[model samples]
Target: MTDDRVLPRAVLWDMDGTLLDTEPLWGRAMEEFARGIGAEMTPELRNATMGNSSVDALTKVYEAARVPESGRDFEADEDAMVARVLELFATDLRWRPGALSALDLVAGAEIPMVLVTNTVREVTDVMLETLGRDRFVATVCGDEVAAGKPEPHIYRRAAELVGFCASECLAFEDSPVGAAATHAAGVPAIVIPSAIPVPPKPTYTYRETLEGLTLDDLAAVFAAR
Candidate 1:
C-alpha cells in the first residue's frame, strides 16, 4: 500500500505542543492567573481548555469558577498571563523530541512547510527564532485570522500562502482543535496527541509523535492513501 511517489506538496505544522514542549509552561501561567483573581484553578478546568484559544480558555475558566469579571478585565488578565508565559518560554523553550529532524527531513525533500498556530506572532516569533526555523515558507497566527481552530480559515490561508491546494497538503497536529481545523479544510491530517487524547474515530490518522519519522515515513504514509 506504499505510494512512495505520492508525497505531499507541503506539510503544515502546529507549533505549541507539537513542535515545542510548552504546554506545561502554559498551564502554570494559567494557574497563576487563576490564583491572582482568587479563583479555584483545578485540573479539570485546565483540561477542559487544554488546546483552546487564550480568550476562549479564560472564558471557560471564569465560567467554571463563577468569577465575575467584565470582558475587558478578563482580556487584561489573559494578556498579562500570556506575557508571563512567553517570558518563561523564551528562556526555557526547547523543541520536542525529533522535531528538528522532522523539519530537516521535510526540507531535504524540498517540501515547503508552514506553521499554523494558535499562538500570537510575538510568541511564535520567539519560538521560530529560538529553533532557527524563522524562514518557514508561511505562517498563520490565530490572532490574525477571524476564527481560530475548529475553523478551517487558518489552514486555508496557510495553503494559499504556500501556493498549494488544501488536498495536496498534509497537516501535523497534536490537538483536537487542530485536527478539526485540518479536516474542515478538506486536508488529511497526521495527529500527534499531546496532553489531550485524540478521539477514537476513523476520520484521521495518528502517530505517537514525530520522534522517529523521516521524510520517507511521511511519503509512505501519504502514498498508502
Candidate 2:
C-alpha cells in the first residue's frame, strides 16, 4: 500500500487452471484417450499431465499406459483429446473463485494484459468465450510457441507479442509448471495454486486465492522482484 508502488508494464495470465476450472475437463478427456489406447489414467499420471503441452502430456499418458512408441499415434491422440475437451468446455466450463473480480481489478487499472497458456489455441479460443476475449490484448497458445510451460518459451513469446520485456511484465500462474516457466522467463509472478501445490521460488509470491486481492497487493509482489 505504498503510495510509490509501481505497477508492471503488462500482466500475463495463465488460462487453464489459473483462471478457468478446465483442468478436470482436460483430465476427463485424457482418461478417455488413454482408455482408447487400452491404458488407464491413474491419478499420478493425470497429475503429471497438468500444465504440460499436448505432445508432452500425451507422451506421458502413453508411457504410463505402457504403450510402446510404435503403437502411439501422437497427432491422432492429441486431436481426439482436444476435441473431447472442447466439448466439455462448451458445457462444463466455470471460472475459478475470484477470477472475475481479479480480472476486473487489473482491467480497471488500464494496464495491458496478455493471456499466456500451455493450452492449445483451439481449446483456448473456446474457453475465452467464458473468460471474455476483450480482457487480453493478445494470447499466446502452446501450439504457437516452440515449447510450452516449464520451458519459458510461451511466457517469453507472450510478453514479446504485447511489446514488453519479460522482466517488465507480471505473470499469474496456478501450476508449478506454469510458475516455473514464468520464473525462467524472468517475470515476477503471483502464484495462486489450484489442484496441485506450487513450490516456492525467489521471484514468486504465493496467494491462497484471488479473492480480496487489491492492486496494492499486485504492486507489492511486482516490486519485490
Candidate 3:
C-alpha cells in the first residue's frame, strides 16, 4: 500500500542518554556523591533519577538514601553532582549507537533540529562546544524552563524556539520521562531506548536504534503512528 503521510516540519533531539552516552557518567557522579554522604547508590536509586534534572533527581536521591537535606543544602548537593559530572563530560562523551549518523541524516535533510533536555545549561554549554554549536539551530535546557520532564514545558518551549507547533515537530527521546514530556506537548515522540529501557507506550513509537534511519523510514513510522 502506498503511504501518503505528512512529514514533520522539524525535529527535537534529547541530549544526555539519547544523543550522547552520558547516562553512565551521570550515574557515576551520583554514586560518588552518595559516597561522600555515607549513602549507598543502588540500581533502584539510579533508575529513579536516570533522566531527571538536578532538582528532580536529588529529591529522589535524598529520599531513597535517607539523607536529610534542606532546600538550600539540596541545591549545594546538586551543584556538587553537576561539578563531578561536568568534569567527566568535558572529556568523555560518546554517541549512542546510530545517533550521530541519524543526526547527520536529519541535518542533511535540512530539517530544523532543536536540542531539548532536562540537563542544566552549565553542562549543556560544555556540550555545545564539544558537539559543535552548529549542529542544532536551537536548544531548550531544563533550567531555562519552568518545569522539567514529564511536564511538557521544556518541549513546548523547544517547539516554540523552532517556530513549529508541537504537532508539526518530531521529538526523539531515550527515556520514558522525556518521551512522555514530548507526547504531552502534542509532539509525536520516537524513543530509542538507552541503557534504561522504556517500556512500550501507546503515546510514542519505539525503535531499537536511530542508526541508518532515513527520512523515508521516519515518514513511514510517523504515518504508521
lDDT of 3 by residue, 119-140 (tens): 9998898888766679899988
Off by over 4 Å in 3: 1-5, 69-72
Model 2 Cα lDDT, one tens digit per residue, 42-69: 8888888899999989989888778888
* Order of models, best TM-score first: 2, 3, 1
**Quality of model 3 by C-alpha lDDT:** 0.84
Residue 140 displacement in candidate 2 (angstroms) = 0.2
lDDT of 1 by residue, 1-225 (tens): 954377888999898888889888888888887777667778778777676777777787777667766543765776787789888886788787788888888888888899999887767777787656654888889888988887899899999998889989988888888888888897788889888887743446788978888766676656667
What is the lDDT for 82 in model 2? 83
Winner by lDDT between candidate 3 and candidate 2? 2
Clashes of each: 0, 0, 0
The candidate that wins on TM-score is 2
Worst 10-residue stretch by lDDT in candidate 1?
69-78
For model 3, which pairs clash? none
Task: List residue ranges in candidate 1 displaced over 4 A.
Answer: 1-4, 68-74, 201-203
